[model samples]
Structure formats: C-alpha cells, structure tokens
Target: MNLTLKIWRQKNANDKGKMVDYKVNDISPDMSFLEMLDVLNEQLINKDEEPVAFDHDCREGICGMCSLYINGEAHGPDRGITTCQLHMRMFKDGDTIYIEPFRAKAFPVVKDLIVDRSSFDRIQHAGGFISVNTSGNTIDANAIPVNKHDADKAFEAATCIGCGACVATCKNSSAMLFVGAKVSQFALLPQGQIEATDRVLNMVKQMDEEGFGNCTNTGACEVECPKGISLENIARMNTEYLKASLKG
Candidate 1:
C-alpha cells in the first residue's frame, strides 16, 4: 500500500511547529502503525535526514504511551485502542494520514510527536495512593469483604492509562476523566477511607495547578478513552469533592 503522511514536526516546545509531508510506499497492511513509522524513520536515517520522533513503548496497548492524533481522532481511526495498536489495515492503500501529537495545555510538545506528560505523574503523586501501615502486621485483603459491584466499578476505573486522550478529545482539554478514574480507584476501597477528604482535595488541586481545563460534561473524553473509562467516575469524584467540602 502507498500512503501519504502529513505529520507535525516540532524541534522543541520553543520552536515553531509545522506539518511536514512524506510518502511511504509498499506498506504492509499487517504492520502496526509504529512499525510503519519505523520504516519511514529508517528511510530518513538512510538519507541522513533527521528521523521523525514519536512516542511508543510496549506496543501492546497497555502503557498508553502512544498518543497520536491521526486524522483528527485520538489514537487514529480505531476504537478502544492506542496509537501503537493501530494497523495500516484500518486505512486504505492511498489514504492520507494526518498525524499529530495529543494537544492540551497541560501537555507541552517536546519534539515531533512526544509531549511532556509528567503532569500526570505529578497529579498521581498528589493523591492517587492509599495509606497503609506496613510497619508490623499485615491485614489480609480478603478479611474485609467489599461489595462485588463496587469492586468491579473500581477495577473499571483503574483501567485508565493516563494517555491524555480524555484531555485531547475534549474541546475544553479537561483532565476530569483522568483525575476521576484515579479518584474512583481509591474511593471505592476500604483502605482509601482514611484520607478521602484530603485525597480528592489535593488531587483536584494538583489537576488545576497542572493547567488542565475544567470539564463541562461534553462526554468527548469518555468517547475517545481507549480503556472505555466511564464518565461515572467523574460524577463519583464530584460527589466525593462536594461531600468533602461540606465536611469542612
């Protein structure tokens, strides 16, 4: 298959970015998107041209590192998959692929297609954990029974990979879905009860500090999330925050 790629090329965050056009020919439909890019990069390297830079790791769709806006959609034309899992078969032989990095105020472009997503790390550090007394005796996880429904919901929310798709797909570039998933993961557990108040407060504070926009319930984030993270988690976080505010 022959395809035309219009990819964004930015030397750094300070540099003016522009879309560059290139053509890849005889591509196998079976090849993953990253593999096709690897072919393109190899071609450029052979010509002594600086290869295109894109973020990808563990192409298995677990790490959520492959964040690309392909043809105006987050993670290419596929549903429920990351950019790394996207294959050329999804496009036609002569398709023109528009590739760009995930755009958000919190996510600054680092190079061609890599954005600084460490803001997510900082938000996680703010309050994505539960405090446990590990000094002495350990409590068996099975000793305390949890409602099957709550556990399932928590597991669902925990599937969020922080890929920033929620932010990129939103017209507001909101991180509510990401932060909601993080909050719901712990909020449904018994161990998280201790700091529920501070957890929601600090995490939301950090989310705002990172410069992510506020969610206005457009539901675009839920639609584009690769893990199918629910918008219910955002509602849960809002309830938790409201309750915490009332307590104070």
Candidate 2:
C-alpha cells in the first residue's frame, strides 16, 4: 500500500509549524500506524533527512504515550484505540493521511507529532492519589466492605489511563472528564473519602491554572476516550466539587 501523509512539523514550541507532505510506499495493511511511521522514518534517515518525532512507549496502548490527532480525530479513525494500536488496514492505498500533535495550549508541540504533556502530570500530582499507611502488616482486602455497586463504579472510573484524549477531543479542551474520572475513582470508595474535599478542590484549581478550558457538556471527550470513560464521571465530579466547596 502507498499513502501520502501531510504531517505537522515543528522544531520547537516557539517555532512556526506547517503541514509537510511525504509519500510512503509498500506499507503493509497489517502494519500498525506507528510501524508505518517507523518505515517512513527509516527512509528519511537513509536520505539524511530529519525523522518525524512522535511519542510511544509499550506500543501496546497501556502507556497512553501514543497521543495523536489523526485526520481530525483524536486517535485516527478507530474508536476506543490509540494511535499505536491503529492498523494501516483501516485506510486504503493512495489515501492521504493527516497527522498532528494534540492541539491545546497546555499541550504545546515540542516537535513533530510530539507535545509536552507534563501539564497532565502536574494536574495529577495536585491530587490524584490516596494516602495510605505503608506499614508492613497486610490488612484483609475486604476489611472495609464497600457496597458492591459503588466498588464496581469506582473500578470503572479507575480504568482511565490519563491519555488526555478527552482534552484533545473537547471543543474547549476541558480536562473535566479526565479529572472527573480520577475524582470519581476515589470519591465512591471509602479509601478516598478522608481527603476527598481537599483533593477535589486542589485538583480542580490546578486544572484551571493549567490553562485547560471548562466543560460545556459537549460529550466529545467521553466519545474519544479510548478507555470509554463516561460523561457520568463528569456529573459525579460536579457533585464532589460542590460538596467540597460547601464544606469549606
């Protein structure tokens, strides 16, 4: 298969960028999208040209490092899939593929197809963890029996891999869904309630300081999220945030 790729190229965050076209030939349909780029990069290296820079790790979709905006979608044309998990078979020969880094003020491009996502790390650090004693004694896993329904909901919310697809897909580039998921994961569980008020307030404040936009109920974030994080998580977060504000 052959493809014409129009990819965004930027040397640094301050540098002017544009879409540069390149042709790739003999790409296998079974080749993963990142593999196809590897082939293209190899050719560019052989010609002494700069290679395209993209992020990936574990290429198995667990790391959430393969963040990309392909052909106007968060992760190409595939739903519930990351760019590294996207296969070339999803396209046809002679197709034109457009690739861009995640477009957000918080995710400025560091180079071609690669954006600095440390903003997310900072937001998570603001309050995404539970404080538990690290004493050697192991407590029974069921020591505090939680309602089965709440446990299931917390587990579902915890599935979020912090991919930032929600921000990339949101018209406002809101991080509410992602933040909501994290908040919900702990808010519903007894283990997360001790510091719940502080956690919600701090995380939300950090999210705003990071320059992320507000959620307008567009629902695009949940749709593009590979983990299927639900809009319900956002609703849950609103309640948590309100309760936190009331108590303070």
Candidate 3:
C-alpha cells in the first residue's frame, strides 16, 4: 500500500508546530502502526532528513506511552486499542492519514508527536498509592477476604494505563475517567481504605491544579479509552470525593 501521512512536527515545546506531509509505499498490512512509522523514519534517515519524534515504549500496548490523535480520533478509528496496537490494515491503499499529538492543556506538545504527560505522574503521586506498614509485619493480601464482586470491579479499574486518550477525547479535556479509575481501584479494596478520604481529595485537587477541564459527562473519555475504563468509575469517584468532603 502507498499512504500519505500528514503528521505534526515541532522542534520543541516553544516552537509553533505544523502538519508536514510525506508518503510511504509498499507498507505491509501486517505491520503495527509504530512499525509503519519506523519504516518512514528509516526512509527519512537515508535521505539525511530528521525523523519524526513519537513516544513509544513496549509496543505491546501495555505501556500507554504511544499516545496519538489519528484522523481526529484519540487512537485512530479503532476501538479499545493504543496507537502501537493499531494495524496498517485498518487503512486502505492511497489513504491519507492525519496524525497528531494528543491535545490537552495539561499535555503540552513536546516535539513532533510527543507531549508532556508528566502531569499524570504528578497527579498519581498526589494520592494514587496506599500507606503501607513495611515493618516486616505486613499482612498477606489474600488473607483480607475481599468480596468477589468488589474485587473484580477493583481489578477492572486498576487496568488504566495512564494514557492521555481520556483527556484528548474529552471535549472538556477532563481527567475524571482516569482519576475515577484510580480512586475506584483503591476504594474497592481493603488495603486502600486507610487512605480513602485523603486519596480522593488530594488527587482531585492535583488534577485541577494541572489545568485539566471539568467533566460534563459527555462519555467520550470512556469511549476512547484503550482499556475500556468504565464511566461508572467517575460516578464512584464523585461519591468518594463527596463523602471525603463531608468527613473533613
């Protein structure tokens, strides 16, 4: 297949970016999207041209590092998959693909297809973890006897990969889905009960400080999330926050 790629290019965070067009030929349908980009980079390098800079680690889709806005969608036209998991077969021959970095105020563009998603790390640091007693007297997690339904729900929420797709897809650029998942993951478990009140409060505060917009329940975030993180998590988070506020 021969394809035209209109990709965003920027030298740095301060540089004004634009879409640059390039063509790739004979692309195999079996190639992953990143592999296709790799082929394009090889072509550029052979011509002494700078290659496009895109974020990617563990192309297996476990790592959410491969964030992108493709053809106006968070991760291309596919559903429930990251950019690296996208296959060339999803496109037709001679198709023109528009690829850009995930757009959000909190996710400023870095270069080319890369953006600063460290904002997510900061939010997580604010309260995503549990305070553990590491004094060699730790209780066995399995011994806690969690309810099966709650345990399943907690595991589901814990599958969030921290990809900015939720932010990018949201018209409000709200991170409610991601934060909700994080909060629900802990809120459902026994170990996380200790920090429940503080966890919701601190994380929500940090999310606001990062310049993320508020959620209006458009549900786009869950639709674009690769892990299919449920919107129900957001409701759970809101409940947690309200309860925490009352307790304080």
Candidate 4:
C-alpha cells in the first residue's frame, strides 16, 4: 500500500519545528510501524537527505522507546500496544498519517520524533528503589509470604515501561499512572516497606519538580498505556501519598 506521511521535523530542541510531507509505497500489512519508518528513512538516505530521528530498541515492544503521537493518538490508533508493536495493516492505502513526538512540558522535543524523557529518570531516581543490606544478611525470599492478590497486583504495576504515553495522552500531561506504577510495585511488597514513606514523598516531589501535570481523572493514560497499567495503581498511589503526607 502507498501512504502519505506528515511527520514533524525539527533539527534541534530550539528550532521551531513543522510537519514535512513524504510518501511511501508498497508497504506491507505485516510490517510493524517502526519498520515502515525504517523504510521511510532508507528512502531519505537514498536521496542524500537526512534521515528522520526516532527512538527504538527491542522493537518487540518491551523497551518502550518507540514513542510517537500518531494521527493525534498516542502510539497510533491502537489500544494496549506501543508504536513498535503497531502494524501497517491498521492504515489503508493512500492514507495520510501524521506522526509527531509525545508532547509534554517535561518532555521537550529533542529532534523530530525524539523528546527528552529523562524527566522520568529523575522522578524514578528520586525514590524508585528499595534499600537493602548488602553485607549478605538479607532475609530469605521464601521466608516472608505475600498475599496472592497483592502479589499479582504488584506484578501488574511493575509492567510499566516508563514510555510516557500516559503523559502524552493526558490532557494535563500527568505522570500519575507511571509514577503510581513505580510506587505500587514497591508499596505492595514487604521488601519495600522500609522506604515507603520517603519513596512516595520524594518521587512525587520530583514529578512535580520536573513540570509534570496533575492528574484530573481523565483516564486516558490507562487506555493508551502499552502495559495496561491500571488506574487502580493511581488510586493506590494516592492512598499511599496521603498516608505518607499525614505521617510525615
């Protein structure tokens, strides 16, 4: 199938960017979205033009690096899949596809579809890990039994890949879902009890410091999340945040 692509082109973060039109032909329905982009880049290179700069790694959709706002939707028109997991069959021949970077104040445009998502790194660094004794005195993993329900919930929350789709889709550009997932992953585990109070506090503080927006219950974040990170995680995070605030 042939397609028209209106992709955002920016030389650098400071440059005022605009959409540039291009055409691709003979696209296969079996091709993943990134594969289509790869074809497009190849065409550009053949013409001695600079290739479009997009991020991708582990294109199987695990790494969450292919973040694109396609046709006004995060990760294209699909549900519960990242851009890398999206297939060209979703579009028809001669369709016009608009591709742009994930937009958020914290995620400033770097170049073309690339944006600075390191804000997420700062938030995670604030308090995403549990402190443990490294002198070989750690408790046995089997000694403490966790509730099956809570363990399942924690595992679900742990699937978040920090892709910023939540932020990109949210009207407020909130990181509540992503941050909540990180907090819930640990808050449900006994090993994370040691830093529960400080973890939520510091992470939330850093989320705000990074210029992420507030959660207004729009629920778009959960829908676009490739991992299907539940809104329950956000609720859990709110409860955790409240308890931490009261005790602090």
What TM-score does model 1 achieve against the real structure? 0.97
TM-score of each: 0.97, 0.97, 0.98, 0.97
lDDT of 1 by residue, 101-217 (tens): 999989999999999999999999999998777788777878988889989998999999999999988999899999999999989988788899999999999999999998999
lDDT of 2 by residue, 169-239 (tens): 89999999999999999999998999999999999999999999999999999889998999999999999
| Candidate 4 residue runs with Cα over 4 Å from true position | 135-139
For candidate 2, which ten residues in a row score worst on lDDT? 132-141
Candidate 3 lDDT tens digits, 1-248: 99999999999999998999999999999999999999999999999999999999999889999998999999889999999999999999999999999999999999999999999999999999998787998878898899999999999999999998999989999999999999999999999999999999999999999999999999999989999999999999999999999998
Model with the higher TM-score, candidate 2 or 3 = 3
Better of 1 and 3 by lDDT: 3
Tell me how candidate 3 scores on lDDT: 0.96
Off by over 4 Å in 3: none
Q: How accurate is candidate 1 locally (lDDT)?
A: 0.93
